[model samples]
Target chain A: MRTILILIKKEFLQVFRNPLLMSILIVAPMVQFMIFPFCADYEIKVLDIAFIDHDGSRITQDIIHSFDASDIFVSHGIIQNKKDAEKMIQHDKIDILVEFPNQFEEDLMNGEATRIAITANAINTTKAGIGVGYTQEIIGGYMQKFQEDNMFIASEEQIPARLNLSYIYWYNEQMNYKNLIVPGILVILVTLIGCYVTALNLVREKEIGTIEQVNVTPIRRWQFLIGKMIPFWILGMVEFIMGLFIMKLVFGITVQGSIPMLLGITAIYLLVMLGLGFFISSVSENQLQAMFIVLFLFIIFVLLSGLFTPTEGMPQWAHYTNYLNPMSFYMEVIKKVVLKGSAFVSVQTETIVLSVMAVIVNTGAILSYQEKSK
Target chain B: MAALTIQKVNKVYNKTVHALQDITFEIQEGELFGLVGPDGAGKSTLFNILTTLLLPDSGDIQILGMDLINDYKQVRQEIGYLPGTFSLYPDLSVKENLDFFAVMYKSDIEANMDLIRPIWRQIEPFSKRKAGKLSGGMKQKLALCCALIHRPKILFLDEPTTGVDPVSRKEFWEILQTIRTQGITVLVSTPYMDEATLCDRIALIQNGKILGIDTPEAIIEHFKGTLYTFKSANIFSLLEALKRCPLQCNYYPYGEHCHIAFYEDMETAMPQFLQFLEDNQQEHGDIEPIRPSIEDCFIEIVKMNRHE
Candidate 1:
């Protein structure tokens, strides 16, 4: 235990001594926290749209005016022909084109149903799909108002009872994307500090041959690894607290669950990450190799953690893969605790899984560390 | 008692490249022993094996009568190793590096102050400076100090003086002498032949094999040829011309002179050699017989092994 403490003290000395690394550990995460939430939002607020109106009727004019007044669609005004609107979309000037069929007013007057063709630029499928939905809703509302004013007397008896639907977002009431993304960025911040720093620091010693010097001593491998782990683990916890502060300061996000419970889960999650880093460093010969391995695993961890997208929407194979991803488990726990005000009883399963992972990975790390090579 | 012993230790890499073959040697307690060889002579490999950083394919190694393979933890506690490369943490201060290793062995600085004081005092002034900022010689001195911080029974130094300046190298050997007097065994390796003479006993090694092991003077005395050194205006051209000489001799350039070892008796061979030089129109100075150094003895043994 004394040897481990000495090793930890030495590691802290080296870490604090490197000015560039210190700034990266403290300052870069804050900068990333400030910028990442706003940029990674999935909600599309503005979409430019053009109209190709074939009917010069009152109803058609009213529909175009209503679309222009809506918040989501920026109407590029009416083009004379369908070809011109298609050209506008192809030139990237418009995201969607609304084409009204010819004689649409006469067809409705004759009691014949007509169609409006909505052509959307499919390059950005998410934006295109959402834009198409907005166009249909606006036109549908206009048609309903048109019928209520002109044909209400004839269709009063024919119109069936309509169903009204109301929506209430459960956890995120305002449906603020920032609230969802800020917590995920916090997870990423803690993970980078936990995994990247520890992995690189150990491998840096190997490249410099200091590990060989340590290997010759009576220091046990577990003692040396634990020593290396403690300093980085403390740094990771410090980064986590700073991230929470940023989340509250910038996004007004507060953990509704018990603070100690959140910290307890974070502590165990960091163990899994640090243990993974230790395993990588022990097997690698230099920092570059360790960096690549950590990056490869980190990418998988973040992408599959439901940070950017819902895990339930993923394919079956990807869902199975998430079972092996530690971040997935932690992300669920953190989201529940931070957003839903969940108590320990709610996040019990994930907490147990992370604890199990911590033990398995750290044991593997200690065992795989070969003090003597054959 | 033997401080460390190795018998028939062999290491093969990837089923080829025999790095150490049938390597056998022993160091007596309090003796300064040298493993003298060039860069690839498997000195570092043997050091790694002895330090418990590597395991031999087949061998028997006893460090203070403890099996090196089975009781590596105890052996590790008793041994101090400074690898060929500078292995101390560069970002750490000098004092931090020393204190760090000192604690690793469960020994404090005050406990081993007398053992390392001679080397420590020279570096104490720079205790706050980062190790990487030190000069080449100072870096080595700091490494030596760190290696000795634990006061192990045997210290393994691999090419500690390889890149150090001459004056510092002399001082380093003096410090080793002092370390020996404190009753700690020192196993040091070097490519410099002059440093071999400072060791109480050295094993001359080449190509993963031990050529000979003895005191430097005895090895020199056992040199099998009449060695001669002579000045030449153009040593390279003289070396080229001597390759065709009919005498059974081995020749190489030594500093500014050419050294030749003759296998034949000097009674007839010397007169014929002078006549051959005259006939070849070679411009040279007087050839004087000189005693062989460790390098000459090493070359003689290597050549003899190759011929057989």
Candidate 2:
């Protein structure tokens, strides 16, 4: 334990002493939190739209006014002809186009239904779906309103039908992206700091030729590993705390769950990361190779963690792939605790999974270390 | 008592590269034993096994009368290790690196300060400075201080002076000598042949095998052939001429002279060799018999081993 503490001290010193690393630890989480939420949103609004109306009817004009009043579409202009509207759509100046048939209101008054045409850019499939749905609803609502005013339809005695989603974001209530992201970012930061740092720890000794000195010593494998891991673990915690503070103050993200529980989960996750780092160091022959392998694995794990996209929406195979991703489990727990005020009982299964991962990785690392005296 | 003992050790890496094969040697208490070999000669691999950083594929290693595998914890507590390359935390202050190692062995820096006092005194002023900012010699000294901070019964230094300047290397050796006097057993490895003379005894290793192990004087005494140094205006041509001569047993370029060894008696071979050069109009320079050094003995042993 003492040796571990010393190792932890050394790891912290390594992280804090390097100005470049310190800056990265502080700035990366904050900047990523600020930019990603605003840019990569799923909610669709404010689509540019153009129209070609040949009907020359009051009802068609009223339909146009209703579209302008709705917040979903930003009307660009009334194009003079269908050719102008088509040109605008082709040039990508507008995302949607609406056209009305000639004499549409006269036909409607004569008890014949008027026809309308709508076209949308399908490149961004999600955006197109939402935009089209919103436009249809607005037009339908306007027609219903006109019918009611003309007494052509009887008023409902009961409340009208509406979609009451009652969305309960499991972890974060306010849907603050930082609250959702900060914990996962903390996990990633700790993993990056722990794995890369510990991976290079032994390999650097080999590179400098000092590994021979240590190899001849009476130091046990566990002792050296513990010594190397502790410092990085402590540094991982420090970075975690810093990230937590940034989430609360800068992004106004609250820690709804127990702080100690959050920290305990983080500590376990760091052990797994550090263990992985040690395993990489044990196998690598040099610092460059060790660092490269760590980065490659880090990218793979982060992408598969399901932090950016919903895991449920992914394909069955992809969802199972996330099961192997330690980051995915931790992200889920962190999101739950910080946003949903979950207790240990609530995230007990995830906690146990992370603990097991930590043990397996560390065991593999220790077993792989070969100490032959030359 | 042997401070370290390796018996019939064999280390095969990944079931392919045989790093160390049937290696057996021992360092008595307080002895400065050197593992002398070129790069890839299994010096570092041998060091790793002894340090318990690596386990051999087959063999028994004992340090301080304790088995390496069984008594690793106690072994680690009693040995000081300085690897071939600088391995201290580069981003850490010189003092912090020392303190970290001291704490690892469950010893305090203040308690062990006297042990590393000599080397630490030199690096004391820069204690607050990051180790990476230190010069090569300074880093070497800091590494030594960290290794010694635990006050181990034995010290392992693997090529400690490989890249340092000549003066630093000399000073570093002097420090090692002083440490040995304090009743600490030192096992050092170096490829530099000249450094062999400074060791109490050295095991010359090559291609994963020990060529010879003995004191410098004993090894040189066993150099069997009469050695001669031949130099001329055209040195390369002289080497070729000597190689073709029937009297020559072995010939290799050493500095500006061609070192030629003969199987025959020196009295019978020398006069004829001079006369042959005279007859060929190639006797314009110098040719004389000389005493063999450890390096010459090493070459002779390596040559004999290769021929066998």
Candidate 3:
């Protein structure tokens, strides 16, 4: 135990002494955290829209005016014909096109249904999908108001009966993309800091031949590994807490669950990640090899971690593979606790799995480490 | 008592390169032992096995009468190893590296200060400096301090002076002598044959095999032929000329002279050798019999084994 403490002290001294590494540990994550959430946003904030208005009536003008007034669509004014609108779309000047029939206003006046064709570019599928949804909501709102004002004049038989739909978003009421993205970014920040640092530290010793000196000592393999792991674990926690502050201050995401519970699970997840780092470092002979291996696994962990997209929507094989990914479990637990104000009972299963992974990977790290090679 | 005993140790890397073959030797307590060989003669491999950092494919090694393989945990507490390379953390300060290794052994510098005092005193002035920034000699001294911090029963130094300046190399060997005087058995490996003479006893090794093992004087005494050294204005031309001469001898360029060991009777062979050199028009100086150093014996032994 004394030996382990000394080793930990030595590791911390080395980490603090290297200014480049210190800055990378502290600064890179903060910069990435500040930049990534806004860049990775899935919300379609702008849809460049153009219209072919065959009917130059006030009703068509009002519908076009509504699209212009909204925050999401960038209205390109009215075009004379479909050919010119198609030409604009081909030129990449417009992402969406709205076409109205010559009888569109006349049909609505006679209490008959008419169609407004919405042609959305499918190149960027998500933007196109969400833009279509926004368009329908705007047109629907305009029609509802139109019906209420004109309902008293229309005969009861001509008026069509409709089933009204309403929605209430439960957890994220405003559907703020930042709230989801910020927590996911926090998970990545904590993971990269923990795993990348730990992985590089040991491999560096091997590269410089320092590990051979340490290996000859009386220190137990696990003791040395734990000592190597502890300082980085603390660093990872520090980065995580910093990310939490940024989440609240910049993104306005306050954790609704118990703070201690969040930290408790974060500690376990760090163990799993650090163990993975140790495992990689032990198997690798040099820093470059370890780096590539860590990068490959990190890519898989982050992409499949359900941070950017919902795991529920993934294919059957991908969902099954996420079970092997520690980041996925941590991502789920963090989102639940932060977004839903979930208590310990709700996150119990994920916590248990993370704890089990912590044991397995750490044991694998200790076992794979050869203090005496064959 | 035997501080370390190895009976028939063998190591084959990748089933092809025989790194150490049938290696067997022993060191008594407080004795300074040397494993002398050239760069690729498997000295580092032997050191790794002795330090519990590697496992020999087949061998029985006992250190202080305890099994080196099975009792490695206890064995580690009793041995200090300075590998061929400078293995201390370069980013760490001299003092920090010392304290870190001391703590690793669960020992304290203050408690074992006397053991490392001789080497530590020289590096203490540079204690604040990072090890990587230190000169080669100072880096070695700091490494020595770290290795001796635990005060192990035996110490392993593999080529400690390989890259050090000549003055520092002498100082390093002197330090080894001082260390030996403190009753710590030392096993040092070096490629310089002159350094081999400094050890109490050395095992001459080559091509993963032990060429000879005994006191330096005894190995010299065992030299088999009449060795002669003679200067030549053109040593390379003399060597080419000698290759054509009909004589039973082993010859090699030694510094500015050619050293040849002849197995035939010298009285008859000497006159004939001079005539042969004259006939070949080889320019040479007076040839005189001289004593063989450890290097001569090593070359002779390697050559003899090759002939067999």
Candidate 4:
């Protein structure tokens, strides 16, 4: 343990001595904190849409204008036909097309129910899915408003029936996409910087030929690896702090629960990052290879870990895969703690799952390091 | 106990290329032993095995009376190794590199002041400099200081002076000698033949085989021939003339002279060689007998062993 402390001091000395690396460690994360949360949003702020209003009635125009006034949906006047609407969608000039049949209001007056078609470009599934949902919400809201203004409920003989849904987005009441993305991306930035720096640190030593000198020393492998891990772990924690401050200041994400509880889980999650980084460092022949391997793993971890989407809603196989992803647990822990104001007991499962992942990955890493050191 | 012992060590790479074959040698305590050989001659391999950095395909090694494999952890605590390349952290200051190794061995730099001062004093002024920024000689000095910071029982230095300047190389050997007086066993390897004289005993190795193991002077004394240095302005024609001349001698071109080895003393063969040179019109060339150098001895042994 004493030797580890000494080695840690040596590692820090080197870390401070390198200006470019130090700046990147501190500065790049600050940049990510500044830029990533705003851009990694899932919310579709604008939906360009064109409409074919065959009814030529006041109700159809009113509904179309209501869809346009939702602040998220915009109207591109009209498309004469389905071919023109498809062309507009393919040209990226519009996103959705709402077509109503002719005599739509007359049929409604005659007590015959009618339907309208909404065609959307489904190339980007998230955008298309959200756009369709927004369309349904606006039309539903318009129907309710029309009923209230006209002061008439649809009886059994009425042409149009009314259904109502009030979407109460729990946790994020205002549906601020930044709130959803910032916390999850905060976990990712910390994990990313932590893994890459730690992996490259040891591999750089190998490239510069200092690892052979280090290998011949009396220092134990665990002590050496742990010593190497501490500095980056501290750096990762610092990056997390910056990300948290940025989260609160820029995104207005108030920390609802124990900050220390979130950081405590972050600390455990960093163990997996550090361990995996050390494992990669030991296996890689140089820093370049180590960087690429860490990057590949980071992308895979973030993508499959439900940072962008809920693991609960994913396919069963993908949901099972999230159990193996440390980031998934961390994302849950952060979101539950910060957004839901959940007590520590509420996130107990995620914490335990994260702890288990930390143990497995770190042990695997240390043992792999021991094997390579031989 | 002897400082180190290796018995019939064999190392083969890729199951085909023989790196070290049937190598056996030992060094006494406090002995400054040298393994003299060229590159790819298995000096580094033997050192790696002894220092516990690499395991041999087949061998038994004992360092300081402990088994290298079974007692590796304990043995590593008593050994210091400076590999062929300078392995100091380039981003670390010279003092940090020194302090790291000292602390690694559970001591401080001040604890081994006497042992490392001879090497450290030269690098003390640049102690704050990054190790990579220092010149080649300074880098070697810093490496030596780091290796000695722990004050191990045996120090393994593999080709420590190969790329260093002559003056610094000489100073390095002087420091090694100084450290040896304090009762530390030293095992150094180098390709330069001149450095062989500094070792108390040396194993001349080539192609993973030990050509000869002896003190430099004894190896030179055992050269069973009278070696002659033949120099002339026109070395090519002179070599051709001497090659055609019928004299019972073996010859090869040395730096500025053609070295010829006679089985008999020069006095016994001089008259016949003089008549042959007279017949070949090469009588004007300077012919003088000289003592056998380590280079001359190494080549002679290599030739003898290859033929046998």
Candidate 5:
């Protein structure tokens, strides 16, 4: 234990003494927190759209007003022709174009219904689908209102039935996407930095030929591994706190969960990360190979860990594969604690999984660490 | 008393590459033993095995009368090792690194200050500086201090002076001499042939094999023939001429001269060699019978061993 403490102290001195690394550790979380949240949103808003109104009548104008009043679409100026609208769409300036047929109002009044065509950029299939659905709803509402005021239809019947979706976002009540993302992002960042840094720790010593010095010493494998991991574990904690503060103060996102519960899960998460790093170091021949392996693992964990999408919503194979992902479990626990205010009992299953993973990885790492000088 | 003993030790890395093969040697207590070999000559492999960092495939190693494998923990507690490369934590202050190693051995710097005081005092002013920022010589001194902090019974230095400047290399050896006088068993390995003389006894190794083991003076004294240092303006031609001459001698180029080992007596051979050089029009050259250095003996042994 004393030897482990010494190793930990050495690791801390190494991390803190390098000014550039220290600054990167502190500032990266804040910068990522500030920038990433703005880019992350499940609900589409302020979609730039263009319209070509051939009808140019009051009914068509009212339909356009409905779209304007809705927060989802921000209408650009009316295009002179379909060709011009197509040009704007092609240039990527407009995400969508709504065009009406000629004499649409006259035809509609004469009992010949007019049809409007809507075109959308389909590259981002999800965003395009939502944008198109919102625009169609607004136009449908305007037509219903016109029919009722003209007495062409009964007022009661003219009121189209709308499906009222009381979206009870299970974990995050306010549906703040940042709250959903912050926890997962924090997990990934810590895993990337923590695992890579610690993995390279011993390998760097080996490369420079200093590992022989340590190998000949009285320090045991477990002590050395613990010593090397503790400082990074503490650094990981600091980064977690910094990320939370940024989310709360800068983004105004509230943490509804117990702080101690969140920290407990975070501690488990860091152990798993550090253990993985030590395992990589044990297998690697040099620092370069160690770093490469860490990066590859980081990429795999971040992408497949259900950080960007719901694990359940993913394909059956992907969902099952995520069971092996330590980051997936960590993200789930963090989100539950910070957003759902979950207690230890509430997240007991996830906590146990993380604990099991920590034990397995750490044991493997220590066992793999050759205590000899070679 | 034997400080260390290895019997029929063999190390085959990855089950194919033979790093150390059938090695057997021992160092006496308080002896400054050297393992002299070129790169890839298994000096490091032997060091690693003795230091308990690597397990030999089949061998019995006894260090200070304790089984090497069974008593590894005790062995580790009593050895100080400096590897070929600088392995100290680069980001930690010099003092911090020293303290860390000291703590690992369950010893305090204050308690052992006197033991490392000689070396520590030289680097103490820059103790606050990060080890990565220190000069090569300062780093070497710091590593030596860390290794000696616990005042172990034995020290293992693997090519400690390889990349160091000549002056610092000399200083390092001087420090080693002092440590030796204090009765610490020091086993150092180096590719520098000149350093062989510094050791009380050396095992000349090549290709994972021990060529010879003896005091440098004894090894030189045992060299079997009259040796000559031959140099001319055209040294290459001189070497070619001597190789082709009907003298029944062993000749190989050494620096700017062809070192020739002749079975003939020096008194009869020197005048003939001079007359032959004059007849061959070789000018501005000299030939002299000289005492063989460890390098000369090493070459001779390697050559003789290859033939046998």
Candidate 6:
């Protein structure tokens, strides 16, 4: 333990001595926390539509009025022909074109079904798809109202086969993108700092041949590694707390569960992270190789972590693979604590899994790292 | 008791290159030992093995009466090592580096101030200067101070004076001699043949094998032939002509002279040597018989061993 304190002292001096690296270590995460939420947003706005009314009728005017009334869309006015509507769509002034058939009102009066052909640009797939969905919903409601006004379907509301489809969103009531994404991005930043800094610390020593000097001493492998890990562990916590503060200040995200519990989980997860760094440094030949290995692993971890996408939507094999990713488990744990205010017992399984990982990976690193390769 | 004992040690790299081959040596408790050879002569490989940083492939080593594998932890606590390269944290100031090493050894800098005062005094003025900013000589001193801060029982220095200036190299050797007076065994390696004389005993090693081991004077006296220092104004051509001559002698380049070994005594070979020099028009410098140094003995032994 005394040796470990000395090692930690040495590690801290080395870390704080390089002012440039220290600045980068502290400032990079702060900038990421401030800007990344805005980049990962998923909301869309502003819809424009054009109409080519084949039949000059009152029902068609009412069909256009439904969309124009909502703030989501604006009408570019009725066109003389389909060609004019297509021209407006080509000029990028419209997102969709609505064409009513020639006998649109006549067919309704004769009790025959009529069709309105809505053609979406489909160039921007998501925008076009959602725009078409909204337009269809409006038309369906308008047709129902039109029939009711005429007393043609007065008993349709009495049908027992309809679904109320009540939806209530918890955690983020306003569907604020920042609230959901900031916590997730904070997990990634913390993981990167923890893993990248530790790997570089050891590998830099190897590059400068300082490890040999340490190897010549009486220091045990576990003692040396423990000492090496402590500084970064403390630094990671420092960065995490700073990130938490910025997260609350910029996006107003506060942990709902016990802050102490969250801190405890973070401390253990950092051990697994530092172990990963040591493992990578043990095998890599140089700094570039270690950097690339961490990068490759980070990419794989982030994609499978359910950070930006839903893990439930993935294949069964991919869904099961998330269990192996520590980052995935931590991401879930952080969200549960901060966003949902989950009780400690509720997150017991993930925390326990992380603890086991911390033990296994750290022991694995200590065994694999040898003072001599041969 | 001997400070270190290496027995039939062999190291093979890449499954082909013999890094160390059947090496054996022993150093007394207070002796200053030097492993003398040129680059790629397995000097660093041997130093690494002795320091417990490397394990030999096929032999056993004992350090301070403890088996290397069984008692490495205890052995490491007792030895101080300076590796083949500069390895202290470059961004750290001299004082910080020293303090950190002292703490690592579970000792205090104040405890060993008397031992490192000569080195530390030279560097004390620049104590706050970053290690990277110090000159090469100062860096050597700082490395030496760090290695000695722990008051180790055995010191292993690998090529400590390989790139140091002549004056600093001499001073560094003086420090080692002073360290020896304190009854600490010192094991040092160097490629500069001149440094061999400063050591009490040296092992002339080449190609992972020890050719000879003895005091500098004894090794020089063991050379079996009369050595002649041959020099001319055009030294390169002189070396070329001597090697081409039908004199049946060994001619190898010493610093500025071509050192040729003749099995016959100098009285019997001088007339023949002068005849050849006349035929080759190599009369710019006088030919004279000179006593052999450690370098002459090394070249001769390497040639003899390689041929066999």
Best by DockQ: 1
> Any runs in candidate 6 off by more than 4 Å, and if so which?
A47-97, A103-111, A121-125, A141-166, B265-268, B281-283
The 10-residue segment with the lowest total lDDT in model 5 chain B: B239-248
Pairs clashing within candidate 3: none
DockQ of 6: 0.65
lDDT of 4: 0.84
- For residue A348, model 4's alpha carbon misses the true position, in angstroms, by 2.2
lDDT of 5 by residue, B173-254 (tens): 9899988988899999999999989999999999999988999999999998888886668876776666556665787878
Candidate 1 regions exceeding 4 Å error are A157-163
> How many angstroms is residue A283 displaced in model 1 relative to the true structure, after the best TM-score fit?
1.0
Query: Can you list each candidate's DockQ?
Result: 0.91, 0.43, 0.81, 0.57, 0.70, 0.65
Q: Give the better candidate number (2 or 5) by lDDT.
A: 5
- Residue-wise lDDT of candidate 3 within B1-308, one digit each (tens)? 99999999999999999999999999999999999999999999999999999999998999998999999999999999998889898888999899899888888899899988988899899999999999999999999989999999999999999988899999999999999999999999999999999999999999899988999999999999899999999998998888887889999999998999999999899999999999989888889999999999999999999999
lDDT string for model 5 (A1-374, tens) is 67777677677766777787777787776788778877877767679888898879877777777777877788896888778788888888898889888898888787665689999998888878988887787787777667767775344554557555456877766777777777777777788667877787778777876666777888777777777777888888888888788778886767787898788888998999899998999899998899889888787777788778777777888878788888888887877787778778888898899999999999999989887634
lDDT of 3 by residue, A23-122 (tens): 9988998898889888988877789998888888888889889987898888999998788899888888889898898788888888777899999887
Of 3 and 6, the candidate ranking higher by lDDT: 3
User: Compared to the true structure, candidate 5 yields what TM-score?
Assistant: 0.93
| C-alpha positional error of residue B147 in candidate 3 after TM-score superposition, expressed in Å | 1.2
Residue-wise C-alpha lDDT for candidate 4, range B1-308, written one tens digit per residue: 68888899998988888999999988999999999998999999888888787888888888888998888888878888989998888888888788788888787788789888877889999988988899998998888888888789999999999888899899889989998998999999999999999999999999999999999999999998789887767777777987775666678889978898887656668888878777877745578889999989998898889889
Model 2 scores a C-alpha lDDT of 0.81
Candidate 2 structure quality by residue, lDDT tens digits, A114-177: 7778899877887788778777887878766766675543346422454434668655555555
TM-score of each: 0.97, 0.86, 0.95, 0.89, 0.93, 0.92
- Determine the TM-score of chain B of model 4: 0.95
